[model samples]
Target: MPASASASSTTPAAGSTIHLPKTSESEQLLKIRHSMSHVMAMAVQKLFPRAQVTIGPWTETGFYYDFDSPEPFTEADLKAIRKEMIRIINKKLPLERIEVSRAEAEARIRAQNEPYKLEILAGIQEPITLYTLGQEWWDLCAGPHVAHTGELNPQAFELESVAGAYWRGDEHNAQLQRIYGTAWETAEQLAEHKHRREEAKRRDHRRLGTDLDLFSIEDEAGAGLVFWHPRGARMRLLIEDFWRQAHFAAGYELLYTPHVADLALWRTSGHLDFYSESMFGPMAVDERLYQLRPMNCPFHVLTYASRLRSYRELPIRWAELGTVYRYERPGVMHGLMRVRGFTQDDAHVFCLPEQITAEILRILDLTEEILSAFDFRSYEINLSTRPGKSIGEDAVWELATAGLVEALSRKGWAYTIDEGGGAFYGPKIDLKIEDAIGRMWQCSTIQLDFNLPERFQLEYVAADGSRQRPIMIHRAIFGSLERFFGIMTENYAGDFPFWLAPEQVRLLPVTDEVLPFAEQVLSQLSGAGIRASVDHSGDRLGKLIRNGEQMKIPVLAVIGAREAETAAVSLRSRRDGDLGSLPVAALLKAAERANLERGATLELASPGKEHS
Candidate 1:
């Protein structure tokens, strides 16, 4: 299967000198991965003579081939298969591409009795081709492979795992065995790829979410519906608070739109016709069908069209933390990343035609500011133009596409142009953030839409007193709070920044004698707007410290007889090492300042470190 955004970015690893390019970015890697799959299929067939091969495709990171076998493959089988693949590679077998007619292809497949190959052949168009390995083995594939097997590095490829897959991904079809493997041009690249896979597992958000008590998706509540635990909710509040403040400061007004609306409204917006598959089935309320909104744009559009607006208010920016629901397939529910219900940080700007570039530039500036605060400083940008089956006139598409380009240019950000890759309504700019491990997650989009305004019949009174359709620019910074939270969690590996941590400080009482003092310190910290709590577990000092570290608490304060008597507490910081004894007042001040500044760590040596 092709790797999704959950897979890490193409950026090089943190502090690593080695760079591993994805298969898409490197043509040589593509051929290597493709040929590796054929070699693997040959190996499997050689080792398990009855194994039948189906489709094998190169993924971004690796390749996988589906097979029909009477028995499932085991770890021992994989080892033997690897040995056979090495033998095949060492033989310097030539891979010759042979284009054959329909009859000839069917004859070969019939001779092999490969039913899956016959089905695949019936569906594909001519000129049908096959690739032969040496003189003995051949399979159906239109390949651009290396000249010989010797070109593949025997030490640079590995069979990773085996999983069950249905034919054509249909559950009704007969299930097959899929073998996943990764290949690289060099042994070092293969080593790097393996290291990244391990690191990805280590930083998996789903695992960290449970380990940190952040969130859950219980089967009792059905799939894809998140239950944000207390700690996770608090952090979410902090993020939302910051987002609201940023929007207000950027001169945008917040709107609280309805979660469900009349079904006719969606039909008017074209979602009912085009996006019904993703939407939940409508419910009848008061004899009228109502839909759980799958998008916030249509609601915003209705709000814009509620009343006539003057030219002076042309560039109106309205934002919302709107919760929306969509029908995600059963097997696709992946923690917070893909969910049935999610709160989007949605915003729409209705501007004059002349204001598109300026509004887009402003959005770019705000996007950078908000995402940078979360420590995602590196970005990969794409400017997507109109698709082949898109709405809006050619002139309008050109204007919208040019506006996005001008904004990116004015912001001095380099972006790749994705021709005919935009939404049906308009052109857009997509931003992907590179995490600490170099994996990219898509979180931001700015689309200049001409369809929404036209559909909703939205108009503003111009300076010349004529009603004109205001340009609607739909943008989302976080896209969805749930997905962004997952990305951020993995980005930090659940060790959140001091400002964003649910419990920024924890007070550990060294002894029963220090309980009163610890409570006093906790009061002071909480009074100063710091998220602090006493350990209160009555555990030993060592255990308390260990527990605090295990929870990934940013700062831990230990109160003992000596320290309490001196009106100070010993502190340990996760970001910075052990901070020496500091008075309760100083601790409160530093924490409050860190939260106020949205800082990653508490800097005690700064000018405001000491409290009066």
Candidate 2:
């Protein structure tokens, strides 16, 4: 997924009776939110007569209205708007839908002196309509509103906040104040919505990134550029190593590609025409233009075109952890989830057209294996068909779509069809993983492109000694390394599993006399391929444990005189509480087992007890 596209809606919490559905999921929410936006507009106009309404629409979470006010709205204005909205809701006024001619609509707008509504009227199609609130206030709208304001629970709605927005989202146009608000069927659902929002805030990646000392975005250097600290770098390396191993096991060979190429390469690949907006400006070098790559697919295509291939070399899978850069607008740049510079775990497969089904199945299997390791077993899959403005033969598009559907069926994964949602160049499959908090994050995609192969003339010799274009499949398990890191951080709430944690174990020495013993234990753990460090801060035992817990270390071991003499260590695990006193050898064995199995918790047995 692109950095600009963030995660989707939240699901109902487990064991909770209240289910907070998104506006898209429920017809009642659609009507309620739609009516709420109009009610809010009426209240705003009643309070600030000079505020002219532009547009008010419902979102997945709630609704927002844009207004061209004389002055920006303040925090106090939001409270006043809420109070006024509640008052209007209490009036039990009938919301009447009125059909009018364009002339009448324009006449009413002229009478009200609302220029924004006039502009909106000019763009819309015929059968103009407006909704009247009570007897005095009204606005142009297409009605699916509640019968009356009495149907709305005044206590169920809230005015969220106010922000500045450009009219029609164009920076060149007039600026407007946008008021965001949320409404639900009942106050209980509203409470649940607020709780989820607060929980999301608590698990925000930016705060966790700082508190855990993982990564940072330095303003001095630039915006949207990530600086991975030592601990973060270590965890990233672990992820990379696992990715490499998984790809190799799945019959993939890794490749290294340049970050910048001649500007003509992009033109030949058609990216210069289609993706120029997201690309950085080209740089002049030696009388030629070189541009930073916003994608890795073109580079892989270049590699395939560089050499002629035979039929026997079909189904070639090549993967790359390629770093790419794009130009993100300043205000749109988020933490690690949305960055200008990030690594893409990109892979491309060149195979015969007939082998699409098998190749897609292989990719899906690998995706599941990799994602399940991080404890994301639940998924929502989407199969997007070709758009109307797409480039491909009808037969080819049908074949590609069929291949995706068949592969999904063979894998027994349920998917929803999204009409006209694919890229202009291909039909694709998108997979969204559900996080621990019931939020869904899009991280994996498999796109079958028929245009790239034709554009680059990527071909191989057929069995009959004729040349044929190879089918190209672009796949990425983690869409962007930085974005995936952010999602995973929030999913785990910064307390990473034992196998993936940067510091798996911390050794706390009881006193000065046990320093040497702690060192020996650390060496043993390190030799066993466990990341362990001796806490040499010389703080009290209680403080040491507290600090270790604060850092979210998986395990904390206490080294004391008796344990040292007995060749044992008292262990406290974040996932498994106290394990009593276990021998150093047992600790090393359990740590190795956890790493090998990618287990979340370590299982260690006492001297005479059986392992659990």
Candidate 3:
């Protein structure tokens, strides 16, 4: 998804992209990394005495120390800082924790003339402790650090980068230079970490989105709003088409809802009360306040309430690619991954109480099918039970919770139980997908709601002609197309599978003589529903091939005089190497089969044999 549309399919060796555990997972590594941050600060202060340290803390990967410096740090400064840190680590300085009174802490901070530290000291409660690194440096901290610097592996640490950050993240305060670094338990762990970081940067969707001319976020248009260019829009249409096919095949009816609704609808739905913080301000429309939708569930609910239904039609499955807008605070949005405006692949299922387990199981199966279609084969599932403060009767909560658990058990998906983590209205199941490089991203969620139905007073005719409330379940597979697209782009490193690529094939004519032949081949491919384009730039044959490959086009058809005469094209595939020569008809059949099967590539090597 970055500048490089990598066609490299070779996964890093099993242990090469090994996971560097979170700071909270390993106490020893946590202490080492935390101590490394302090060591880095000490080294920086020793070199640049004018620098005043503020907050230094360990992140999921490593640590960062924010300092108010006279000038911004340069690339050369990182090398100098690393050298100083190594010298300090070699000294094996003993880190001693000293408990001090607030007065004493204030006095020490004042003596050092660090206004940032003094401010931090004032805000913290009593029983302040200071960890002194020998006689050279000391700072206010609540640490569980190693006793000595010798416990750290010098080879395992590296100074990574520096950026400008507001002091305490307040733009009004002095801007501080933040130096980021990562320290691991061993050199191998560090190497794996570096590898992952490098790969992540290469796969960063924000960069590739521009390089591939896919999508963009404009400052003038508004923050967190995406504009899908032609190529991106074409791929989105393909994705949406595939999604509709799957949903219809799975017995789901699509729905189209208004973007703005009466504010009373949100108030009745409890969104105005509970979710107002995320909602946009209401607008007056002919004296009636109308609110931009932040969720599509309320509208779907009203649709059910529009008419009475019988128990015979208990399960009403409706889906929508509903675009919703929510207020995202400035400085928090990142590319398409975190956007204020996004379209959610949302669905809601209303069924009889007894149908809960079977329905949930069906949803899970559907989720797996949809996710695996995009190559997200592995998942981490979590079943969150009712929270301490939640609606619905205890019996209803137990029934819904047990239904989720039973469905997961029947699906044979091992999941972790999160105690009291459900939404105030219902229990929920959260799913995170692991990508090719071992990065995990939370996407899908299936939430069982009992409160909304009760709030809306939704009912259906029972078998005995009595009115009964139907159970409601809310679910989302891709969460948001914007986010899933970003994840997918990064996962494939912008080299989409053959069936998913916007431009599936490019016909490259080696000579002007074969131009007519290229046009004929294009027509055949297009007739078969394969996205194909003929390069008519009049560039050299090699330049055409290079340009096709650069765009990550799946199939590059080399049409020369020889190919034209024979009614064949030499295919150079990005997925599988050179497919020597194929009759235009054979090529059409292979491409069609791949598209029909949603296969990643055409395994032409063994003709009829699939790649498995």
Per-model TM-score on C-alpha atoms: 0.96, 0.96, 0.92
List the candidate numbers ranked by lDDT, top first: 2, 1, 3
Q: lDDT tens digits, residues 1-612, model 1?
A: 111232346566877777888888889988888998999999999888899999999998889999999989999999999999999999999999999999999999999999999999999899999999999899999887899999999989999999989889877788899999999888988888888889888889899899889899999988899999999999999999999999999999999989999999999989988899899999999999999999999888888888899999879999999999999877667889999999999999999888999999999999989998999877888888889998888887778788888988888887888999999888999888888889888899998888888888889889999988888999999999999999999899899999999889999887888898888888888888899999999998799999999899999888888778888888889988787788777777788888889988887853322211
- Per-residue lDDT of model 2, residues 169-223, tens digit only: 8777998999999999999999998988888888899998998899999989999
> After TM-score superposition, what is the CA distance of residue 216 in candidate 3 from its true location, in Å?
2.1
TM-score for candidate 1: 0.96
In the predicted model 1, the residue pairs found to clash are: 8-439, 9-439, 9-440
Error of 1 at 327 (Å): 0.9
Q: What root-mean-square deviation over C-alphas does model 1 reach?
A: 3.4
Taking the tens digit of each residue's C-alpha lDDT, what string does model 3 give over 1-612?
A: 101111122235245655567786689989999899999999999989999999999987799999999977999999999999998899999999999998888888888899999889888887889899979999899998999999989999999999878887866778889999999999988887788778889899999899888999999998999999988888899889899888998889999999999999999999998899899999999999999999999999999999999999979999999999999867668898999999999999999988999999998888888888899877778889989898888988888899999998898887889999999889999988877787778899999898889899999999999999899999999999999999999999999998888889999898788899899999999999999999999899789988988888899988888889889888889988787778888899889998888889886635422211
Quote the lDDT for 209 in model 1. Answer: 90
Q: Name the best candidate (by lDDT).
A: 2
Off by over 4 Å in 2: 1-8, 606-612
Instruction: Give the distance in Å from residue 136's predicted Cα in candidate 2 to where it truly belongs.
Output: 2.6
Model 2, residue 142: displacement in angstroms?
1.4
Against the true structure, candidate 1 has what lDDT?
A: 0.89
Instruction: Tell me the deviation in Å of residue 364 in model 2.
Output: 0.6
